[model samples]
Target: MIDPKLASAAETFTLQCVINKRPVSVDVPPAKRLLCILREDLHLTGTKRSCDIGRCGACMVLVDGKPVNSCLTMAYQCQGKNITTIEGLAADGALNRVQKCFLEEGGYQCGYCTPGMIVTVTALLNKNPEPSMAEIEEALSGNLCRCTGYGGIIRSVLKAAEQGGRRHAGRHESA
Candidate 1:
């Protein structure tokens, strides 16, 4: 069953933002988590929900070129912001370089954390292009993945960085 508060919240607020370079408008409650808004309201479920808090990073999204835990962010906070999710990473059905690297490196096992990991790594490579091991670790510190043991995950990111990914620094790139 849907919560009455969520319904009421949806009725009380309206948000306007660009998601994956496309403008989106939603009516939502002020307190609605960005995760819910993305998955439930906007149907962008590529950004998963795990732990329901900021620690998991499962709901990571790019808000104006920075990675943010969407589970902890208010839906209304995204008004007029540029938001990017894992779904937005690809263009014309081609995998982004990070996604491709992750696939080749076997960065994911169960794949539950793949989206968040990709989101973080995408943001990291965008900012650092050629991040050191420590920077990669720091960029991914917020996300938790029990499947890949983080070995293949880090390697995939490093490989992406070595492959012209640095050119995307501080910007969002579509695969």
Candidate 2:
């Protein structure tokens, strides 16, 4: 049960983007948020949907290696850009250093916000391999975790940096 006019209008705009090193083209409404496209269309649900107003970083993803709030980004605006979701962080059945550190450090409690936290830390560590405690705090300010009290998460980031995670940070590959 759908309207033909609205469907046609939605089909008018096609978004072409590179996602996790793979080229993808999908027909979408011009005003559709990139979040919906990723979750609904592309089925990349690793990016969580919380606080849809952009106050929460649960929907964070990487655009051209920079962290962006996918909920606030329009699908049409992602044309020809590189988009990386949490699913892209691993390679060859191996978890990246950041993810491993998060696992070992007990960074997650409920695990709802782990994806965004890991993605943000990946971008931060990519830019600053050996980030100070203050730098880590500043980078993670936008993300909110209701569980685990952030102590384990901070330790995970610091531990990843100590393990030389910079090599894997910001490195996106096909999932």
Candidate 3:
């Protein structure tokens, strides 16, 4: 029932955005989800695609420094925005404090949800460097981790905060 020309136009738009500190340009359909673009097109598979419905928080990414569900975000809407994924959390081959703490604290199991969890926690720490236990729980409410029971994850976030995570809040690029 759609016009052919209109459909073609919608399928051929360009998206220009910075992802993981690198500028990328892709030609994609207007309705393409950012998750698909990141995983399928850009090959940034760090952003997992578990629940396509956006409830599981498996596709979380940072859009302009705010955490968002990439599965619910349209690729077209990402134009001119800066996106950060789990892969961007390191600098010059050094893991950020959050990531290091997660590993040291055993915050992940099976690793299916680690990337999204890390991304969401990173955003929370950036906004509130020293979030209380309730605040950390509230910020991570959307992200689910089945294997770790979340105790270790909470400890990891707390430990990262204690290690001056705020000092490196906005540093998502390699040095």
Give the alpha carbon lDDT tens digit for every residue of 69-89 in model 1. 998899778889998889888
lDDT: worst 10-residue window of model 2: 166-175
Cα RMSD, each candidate: 3.1, 2.8, 2.9
lDDT of each: 0.86, 0.87, 0.86
Q: In model 1, which runs have C-alpha deviations exceeding 4 angstroms? A: 1-11, 165-174
**Per-residue lDDT of candidate 2, residues 43-62 (tens digit):** 99989999998877999999
Q: Look at candidate 2 and tell me the lDDT of residue 174.
A: 24
For candidate 2, give the lDDT of residue 79.
89
Displacement of residue 161 (Cα, Å) in model 3 is: 0.7
Clash number for candidate 2: 0
* TM-score against truth, every candidate: 0.89, 0.89, 0.89
Candidate 2: what lDDT? 0.87
- Residue 147 lDDT in candidate 2: 88
Q: How do the residues 88-149 of candidate 3 rate in per-residue lDDT, one tens digit apiece?
A: 87755678767888999999989999889888887888777779899998999889898889
